[model samples]
Target: MHLSKLFENSNKSSPKRTGETRKLFLKKQIFCILYLEEHKTIADLCIPVGVSIPTMTRIMHELMDEGWVTELGTGESRGGRRPVYYGLNPSVRYILGIEMTRKYTRINIFNLQNKAIGDTLQIDIELDNAPGTFIELKNHINQFIKKYKLDKKNILGAGISIPGLIDKKSNISYTYPNLGQKPLDVVFGDLLKIPVYIEHDTKAMALGESWFGLARNRSNVLCLNVGYGVGLGMIMNGELYQGLSGFSGEFGHIQMIPDGELCDCGKIGCLETVASGSAIVAKAKQMIESGTNSIIRKLVGGNTEKIKLPVIIEAAHQGDQFAIELIEESGSYLARGLASLIHLLNPEMIIIGGDIAPAENLILDPIKQKLNKYTISRIRQDASIFISELKEHAVLLGTIPVVMNRIFSDEPYINNIHNFNKS
Candidate 1:
């Protein structure tokens, strides 16, 4: 039976569906809980949904038969006989995750257990909003599916995380205003012939950190994506806070160095202009070109153009004082902007991610030093800063929750017995 049938046929209401609707709601609720918590006994599951033991046992049997749930042996016995534990069937379906940045794109397939099936395929596809960009992306997705020999029927959906201002209610990307203003999810969905969901890259990163990385179990957090351009993803009050229009965390554009440098966003002294990867590289290149004694020129083989964030970080690691100073300067400016956030949001954890994350303490130390001077001691003490452990994979892993949330929200329970009736 195709899972799409369950989602597509969920909304038809009739007197005959009264009992099925209630049952479907319960089944979905149980599925969601098990998806998050993994294996659980019928008795354990019943406590959350307020369902009777007998009723939950019956539903669990039905789910197992439907291939949506599986019995994973037994748990330790507290008394008498041991209890059986159930979890989502890992082989039942798959999810496609696509993480796009300004310079490249990555694609991978994930199973129901949130594990990647194969190596993530990365390609150089610059996201410039050209008409050919989507076509190129669609072609790669097709190739990835064919390469993996994935069953189209079993592929549940695709989740895309890209740099843009995505409107939550309309699901439209306002940043790519020149690209006909179509919702990115719709375009990808039509091309892939599967349901697709879209999310801002940094916001999705925050979701990944919240679910699988260091931000887990932490209520208030700030995920800073210190890539070519800096961006922020905020987790406020235990939820991913997407402000009105899903554009809450535009941390890069905040003014920092009054009349210092012009930003690509048509602003002067934006935080990105001073503290982003691009800014670090630009500073390194200017310093090298000025005949400063540094190993960065040798690392880039005399090509200043090749001196990117990684090269600068490598130089800093190799005891190059010039490179270290550049990173420290960037961190200093970053701390100034973050100090304001500390005073305002008072986040519990600030996660630094992206290309600069590999520098680790080199960047963190300077930011910590500056935070002391700029922020109130009491407020700044509440937020602990650290590099993201998820690093590059955060955007891809983030796609999981983005797609699942959309799936569970819109899909309802439909009485389609023929699809699942296996006697």
Candidate 2:
């Protein structure tokens, strides 16, 4: 049976089905809310769900009878009877989350409760937009499902957090434009024989923060992904702000220096050129080759080619002046970019995530110190900066909301259900 049947109402006739469609829509919203934050009483659910007490109670009962929800004991009593707490049934459905970078891919299966069914599988597949890349990714995903013995019918959809310029409306990835004649999502959906939703890597991280990390319930946030390259994800007015072309958060490409190093995006002075992981490595290699003294030389056994961001961070941890200076320089450059973001957006929080996040105070202290000079005191104080605790898993966890939003966002619930059934 198609997964759409899960949302279908039993009565689908003239007067009998007058409010069935509205019930179906309400059912979708209730599921999404429960999926996001579990264990809500009927009273707790009515306001956000915009339904009355009896209506919510009836819907909750229906969802429980359908095996989508479960009663989890009772909550505190105000005066009379204690309210029953309800939540999603962990085994009712599953979601597949995939995080793909230029160098590797990670996949995991999650139940409705957002708990992993098994260990996350990491496959080393160089993502160069080659047809073979997708082929290999499909093979790995297929094998992973088999290893877990999960029924394909029970898995709702797959969410991919990939590095690319993707238009969610068109489901096309401009970065991998030559991979297929059809849209990238269609290509993957065909290969996997399931619905697939794709999102840009940085924005995916932002979604992760919104749903699972520091940005949750916050109105305005800026998530900076500082790894292989600098990337930005913005949550404005409690929504992920994908710009006119779904490319709004290209924070890395914004010009920071007038005539600095050329970025891979074919522009001069992109912020990533000076403040990203790649930039940190580039500076380290240059200085090492030029005979600058540092503990990094000892760490890498005098091989500059082996230098990377983590090594420099390690050197700084050991009190190496050169490494400390490199991080400080990058932090200062990052501050310059952030100052502009503060003045323009006035976000409530700034989350620093990705490979360089482990640098911790080494990176935070500098950015904070420099902000004092670069930003207005009141404005800077309004935006609290934090390092993401979600760490390596941020992008992966993000795919959950991306898939959920795609399923629940727009079109009439019945039409969406019918479309899924047809697909």
Candidate 3:
């Protein structure tokens, strides 16, 4: 299906007949239409959004009055008068995306077209300190908005993506035990005062890739996030498959060895314990402690405590034999896990994303080599594997679609605004 058509069909709903309905209603329509066909006529929008010609006419007038949309030229008619074309103004609103991982947080601002309008900020904020962590996050977002001089009223919403289990129904992150009694959205939204949306970091990345990156126009895609942990995000039949409680893609905890290395989740032989960045660093530390003597020792310069994933990747890139060995082993383990996923899902494509993907061919080559041997040749031939186009920023970009879905889906936010205006 055409990408724009998919977006438009996804938003087939009633016309919100209210003056105070969040401008997002119009914003979403404009975004969907522009993204789908680069332009749309009022009649085209009326049929898709389930509104009559008159309602669409009024909405378009309001959009123009608010400066959120503008009238382009006219479309040639089949048997009637030429119809006027409309498009999103592209300058009236923006979206902010926050990608949170176990190791770092990145914030970005984007225009209606999903183009980065300003700088992206990265910070190291540990999940262990929940209260202080979001406090710092709030400060960062406030500063970002101030720095860009963006109007909060014109901001659509902020989407936050975090690693680990997320209860989208409750807007709470269950993995951050430190947060104790509060839902993440409640806390973050109170501070931001605008709508705040939260999503599993991996799923967000998958959505990001599906909407604007490598997975575009492809259904049944698998996104692997190789970061501080390993995660999987599945897009099946052109929709994100968040099975049973929105925790489907917990690939990191999949058992690789019956009683192998221990994981922070208290499970034995979990894939992440041996394949994630943290796992790689732990294995490297253990090897160094065993007195295996290599350039990694000198790279750390006797401070074994400072060994990190990037340092190891760099060393491997620089031809450090031991580092290469570590990455190869991790890649092989990852391949074993992916082999199982391929057999079960039969995805059309598998995209490797997250921080570790930057290692590029160094890591991907081993994964491909191992999969060639592990997966059934038939399934292997059907599936193609490639690095993610959005890389580390996929989660943040994914937030755009998340918020768009929320606004356009059958939800109370838009309904309440419409109802309020009617009353």
RMSD of every candidate to native, in Å, equals 5.1, 5.3, 6.6
| CA lDDT for candidate 1 | 0.85
Candidate 2 clashes between residue pairs 3 or more apart in a chain or in different chains: none
Ranking by lDDT: 1, 2, 3
List runs of model 1 lying over 4 Å from the truth. Answer: 1-4, 9-17, 176-178, 410-423
Q: By TM-score, highest first, what's the ranking? A: 1, 2, 3
Which structure among the candidates has the greatest TM-score? 1
Report the lDDT of model 2 for residue 19. Answer: 67
TM-score of each: 0.92, 0.87, 0.85
Residue-by-residue lDDT tens digits, candidate 3, 40-148:
8887776556578887787778667767678889877888898888877776677778888776788888887778878789888776764677778789889998998
What is the clash count for each candidate, in the order shown? 0, 0, 1
What is the lDDT of every predicted structure here? 0.85, 0.84, 0.80
Predicted candidate 2 versus true structure: per-residue lDDT over 308-328, tens digit per residue: 888998999999999998889
Q: Model 1 over residues 93-158: C-alpha lDDT tens digits?
A: 888999988789999999889999899999888887787888888898998888878887788788
State the local distance difference test value for candidate 3.
0.80
Winner of 1 and 2 under lDDT: 1
Cα RMSD of predicted structure 3: 6.6
Clashes of 3: 1
| Model 2 TM-score, 2 decimals | 0.87
